[model samples]
Target: MSSIKEKLSKPFASLVAKRIEKWARNPEKTQQKVFRNLINSATDTSFGKDHNFKKISTYEEFKSNVPIRDYEDLRPYVERVVNGEDNVLWKGKPLYFAKTSGTTSGAKYIPITKESMPTHVKAARNAILMYIHETGNTQFVDGKMIFLQGSPILEENNGIKLGRLSGIVAHYVPKYLQKNRMPSFETNCIEDWETKVEAIIDETLREDMTIISGIPSWVQMYFEKLIERTDKKVGEIFKNFSLFIFGGVNYEPYRAKFENLIGRKVDSIELYPASEGFFAFQDKQDEKGMLLQLKSGIFYEFVEADKFYDENPERITIKDVKLEVNYVMIISSTAGLWAYNIGDTVQFTSLKPYRVIVSGRIKHFISAFGEHVIGKEVEQAFNEATENTSITVNEFTVAPQINPNNGLPYHEWFIEFENLPENEAKFIKDLDNSLQQQNSYYYDLIAGKVLQPLKLTKIKKDGFQNYMKSIGKLGGQNKIPRLSNDRKIADKLYELQLTK
Candidate 1:
């Protein structure tokens, strides 16, 4: 059965590849069609009437009438929908609301209309399918695949279900593939991440797992539990495991740790998905970036990252994007998000294929003293620092330490160790040196004495986890902020340090 499924996946994935290629070849036309379809689908709704969606035929016209908005801007319509108002945002009330963390707001309830489910869920499946098509590694479909997901049980918000995006996606896993899914339904619904992982360990211990997917940090925790229970390397426990899929966070810092934990090298794929929509995925092994999902029920725009905080930043469409320019991503998707700033920054790596590398979040940066440092640069520094040393960071976050009262400002890193480097000072030095090499602005700040060198703050074992648990956020789809310009998270970590 596995061999037969493998053979069938090749042809099906080939068709998806062809469609994606065709869409990439003429993005402008494809985007226009997507826009038209969206307009037609929502024309009778209240938002459509207010925006005069019926008369909008061209991109310029659409832009002229519809203003750019973020989550706050759309909250009114979402609130109306939450009150059981139909045809408020889209044609009808959303099927589900994907609950995600908001930067300033407590939590954002992003509408997940039936129309938008394909973009969020099917695009993920297509990512794997395309990977298989490119690599001819159909054997990945031969055995059980473990997806560490949020609990599927949802909370009712008015008439709509509200839950994590992963939980919503899990509900749509094809029936044909259910047999190959790991961690029984009861284990998956455990609510607490630690307890769920423990149940998963017992349930999947002897299963023929071939693929595993989750956020890198949580997956590492799961791997540690597996190793503790079995006293065997992950490679030994799941000999057939071949592919590892990860998203929702940067994977570079965790790469060394994962390679060590698994006890062997294996294929890994990166995806860029948000509650709003699935944006991009790694399409080739040799590629340095992910292919943009241009035709996946979303129209994308980019604003120069440096100017994104400005009152009226320039919005550049797909046609105007330049290679290597860091831009904050804006999307108008079937999820009823119009020119919404998703708070993510990306740089185009290939214009021909429309591939982009996610640089960092708009809110996740250290820019004190005019030295703008994004997550990608920080991850690169960590990767470079650990390359020649035995240091393997299990978890880490950085924040700007402005006005330490006696000295210049510097980046303060809070890190938990899986393996400590022999020369800890050398590790810190290497990290600082690598950052200077990767980001010229940061280097200039150091050279000009505008900022002091970076400082490392060691976090004890499970410090991050304990903090999250204390705040009642120690569960699926939640992550510690990696970088911050403000002292909110830094102060909390310091408080946690006092307790430790």
Candidate 2:
């Protein structure tokens, strides 16, 4: 059964790919028009009876007239609908809510309508297609694909149904092909989150996986578990795996360790996925890769990062955004979110059709210490430091911790070292210097005493895995906090580091 599905999926995906390729040729215009049409249709269906639906003539009109909404603003509407209220957001009855765990926020219940289900599946398929194109590996159509996703079961009035997204995809995937898959779901669904992860690790270890996909931090943790579970190394267990598809977090910090674990130079595919929608994916051919996507289904807006929410925020349509300028992204998707700030920052890498790189999150910036350090900035600093010092970091986390004695703040770095050269102090100095040069706020904090000098703490090899274990978040979908804005978590982590 799975073999038959694999054979069919190839041609079906190929047909989708050809259409996508044609659309990518003139994506900016194509996407803009498609966005407009979807918005118009949805608006017509939503308000057509009460009053005539207003047609937006220009991008400016769409940007200025349509009020921007955040997730919090939609909470009331979402909650009402979830509790059985009829609403415009749900064209048909909503099947279920896709519960997602956030960084600072505990959990978010995103309303998932029947219409939105296709977008999730399409996005997953797009991710696979992007992976194939980048690596020039056509075998993926024939090979088993693994999606390291959240659990597939949902708690409901009539017991737990399939997770809104995961369950739907699982149901639709050709059963013959199902045997080639692994999920963090299964019987572990009823277990405590901690025990569930251990069960997931146990199950994932049994597969002879060809492709592995998940959040990078979580994937790394799984590898650590594999090390503990068996005498075989990660390279031995995943010897058949050819590609690693990662999203949801930056992978630069763990790239070296991941490569070492895999035992070969494995290709990586990056994706931009959120509860709202899977917005963009890396192009297969480019070095950094181009971001291509379903332009017609979603409208995109960009506001300059520095100018976000200004008195007159300078806004650009997908067509107008320039290469290399970091901008906060806004999306008007089929989910009935209009002019919504998705909390992600992106920069265009090419303009012929429009390709982009996910820089970081708007909320992920470090500004409490006055260092306006974004993810890209940190990535640059890390790369420069790594190149200069020749020290490879397995995993790292940065946070601002208030000093208990002085009530002052300081930037703390928790790093897992693979090999520290004899001149460790010199290496730390060089890395610090590189950060100061790359980030002015970091320089100010060090020089003007806004914060204490940067401090580095080395952990035992695979220290991050142990940290995750100690927190009872050892595997599956959980991730180590990469950057902490609050002091409570940071302080606790600091104490953990001290004891280590």
Q: Clashing pairs in model 2?
A: 1-176, 2-176, 2-177, 134-284, 152-163
Candidate 2 residue-pair clash tally: 5
Stretches > 4 Å off in candidate 1 = 498-500
Per-residue lDDT value at 59 in model 2 = 70
Residues 341-440, model 2: lDDT tens digits? 8788888887765777877778777777667777777666666667644467767767666654664577667777776646766666766787788777
Q: TM-score for model 2? A: 0.85
Q: Look at candidate 2 and tell me the lDDT of residue 160.
A: 19
Candidate 2 local accuracy as lDDT?
0.66
